[model samples]
Target: MITERKIDLTGLKCPMPIVQLAKLIKELDAGEEFTATADDPAFCLDVESWCNKTGHELIRLEDSNERLVAVIRKKISEVE
Candidate 1:
């Protein structure tokens, strides 16, 4: 079963939003998903890059009003 979560980073700036996201993602089980909302103008690009680098799926990204919303799915862990 996949679990969904949401995080609000609207008032944060720069790396704080990404930092908080990373922290939350750590707590989620593999295949779980989350939606994050932020007001920082750089959030869109930052989220895209973060997902790519972290191997998570960036399912959707869009702007609503003045806020940026991102949907992401956690990647399954690989055994080394």
Candidate 2:
């Protein structure tokens, strides 16, 4: 069984995937895991860099199997 929060950006372009991801990230609580699938070829590297720059943890990056799917986990930060 596939147990993960899936965000599909299969028909999106560059920047859109990241935009969508950013929106989702903001709504995600700490310790939540999100898997995003994007058709944008540059998204693989873009999101990776974005994650690194933003301090979000990237669990895995599978870019060339069947689609561009990035596994990301939120950091521990208590929200008010």
Candidate 3:
């Protein structure tokens, strides 16, 4: 079974949300997924780009009313 850790950044801006995600994701083990909620539209692309650059997996990007939900998987290894 897989468990998800949810982080809400509803009122946060672009870099802050992504920056917070970077720190939070570092605390999670590999294979674990994190769901980040934000109201900043830029976060969708920013988060995706950040994950791509860092080699973490982007599982999903969805919109729920006023919030954008980004699901990211922590990389299994840091050897990249």
lDDT of 2 by residue, 1-80 (tens): 33568899998987788888889988888778999888788888898898887778999999786588889988777334
Model 2 Cα shift for residue 47 (angstroms):
1.1
Report the candidate with higher TM-score, 1 versus 3: 1
Which ranges of candidate 1 are over 4 A from the true structure?
Answer: 78-80
Clashing pairs in 1: none
List all candidate RMSDs to the true structure. Answer: 1.5, 3.3, 1.5
Mind giving the per-residue lDDT tens digits that candidate 3 earns over 1-80? Answer: 67769999888875799889888987899989988889998887888899889899999999777679888889898974
> How far off is residue 40 in model 2, in Å?
0.8
lDDT of 1 by residue, 14-51 (tens): 99999998999999998899999999998989999999
Q: Which stretches of candidate 2 lie over 4 Å from their true place?
A: 1-3, 78-80
Write down the lDDT of every candidate, Cα atoms only: 0.92, 0.84, 0.86
Ranking by TM-score: 1, 3, 2
| Alpha-carbon runs more than 4 Å astray in model 3 | none
User: Which pairs clash in model 3?
Assistant: none
> Candidate 1: how many backbone clashes?
0
